[model samples]
Target: MTYNKRICVFLWLVKGGISVVLEMLGHVKLALKCVTERERIERK
Candidate 1:
C-alpha cells in the first residue's frame, strides 16, 4: 500500500510538471508571434 502511494505521488508530480512546462511554452510561442508581427509592421 505504501508503494502504491509512492507511485501515485510520482505520477502526479510528473503530470503537474508537464502541465507547467506546456503552459510556459504556449506563452513563449504567443510572445514570439507578437514580436514577429510587430517587426513586420515596423518594416512596412
Candidate 2:
C-alpha cells in the first residue's frame, strides 16, 4: 500500500511540473507575439 501511494505521489509531482513548464512556455510565446506586434507597428 505504501509503495502504491509513493508512486501516486511521484506521478502527481511529475504532472505538476509538466503543467508549470507548459504554462511558462505559453507566457513566453505570448510575450514574444506582443513584442513582435509592437515592433511591426513602430516600423509603420
| Whole-model alpha-carbon lDDT for candidate 2 | 1.00
* Local accuracy of candidate 2 as per-residue lDDT tens digits, 1-44: 99999999999999999999999999999999999999999999
Q: Once model 1 is optimally superposed onto the true structure by TM-score, how far is the C-alpha of residue 24 displaced, in angstroms?
A: 0.3
TM-score of each: 0.96, 0.90
lDDT per residue (tens digit) for residues 1-44 in model 1: 99999999999999999999999999999999999999999999
TM-score, predicted candidate 1 vs. hidden true structure:
0.96
Candidate 1: 10-residue stretch with minimal lDDT: 1-10
Off by over 4 Å in 2: none
Query: In candidate 1, which residue ranges exceed 4 Å CA deviation?
Result: none
Residue 8 Cα positional deviation in candidate 2, in Å, after optimal superposition: 0.3
